[model samples]
Target: MDAKLLEILVCPVCKGLLHLDKARQELICRGDRLAFAIKDGIPVMLESEARELPADEEVGQ
Candidate 1:
């Protein structure tokens, strides 16, 4: 992901900061517990497209 794009990207649901998980290729919003998938170097920020994070799941850096 581009650093500039990542800086401007925010959680679509909560408008909070997103941490990039390169391994999973997802942008994680800890506050909302949503995982936005990154496809073809673009982030899919839609809430409906996001994966709901389990309570026990760790939001990794």
Candidate 2:
């Protein structure tokens, strides 16, 4: 993900900050408990396209 893009990207549902999980290629929204996937270098930010995050998952940069 681009550093500039990550700085501006937010959760579409709650307008919350997102943490980039580079290894998993996902953007995590802790407030909404959701994860937006990055497919082929493009972020899928739609709420319907997002996946529910697991309780044990940790959010980090």
Q: What is the per-residue lDDT of model 1 for residues 1-61, given as tens digits with 9 covering 90 to 100?
A: 9999999999988899999999999999999999999999989999999999999998896
lDDT of the candidates, in the order given: 0.94, 0.90
Scored against the true structure, residue 9 in model 2 reaches a CA lDDT of: 89
**What's model 2's overall lDDT?**
0.90
lDDT of 1: 0.94
TM per model? 0.95, 0.89
lDDT of 1 at 8: 96
Highest TM-score: which candidate? 1
TM-score of 1: 0.95
Model 2 alpha-carbon miss at residue 55, Å: 2.1
Summed backbone clashes in each candidate are 0, 0
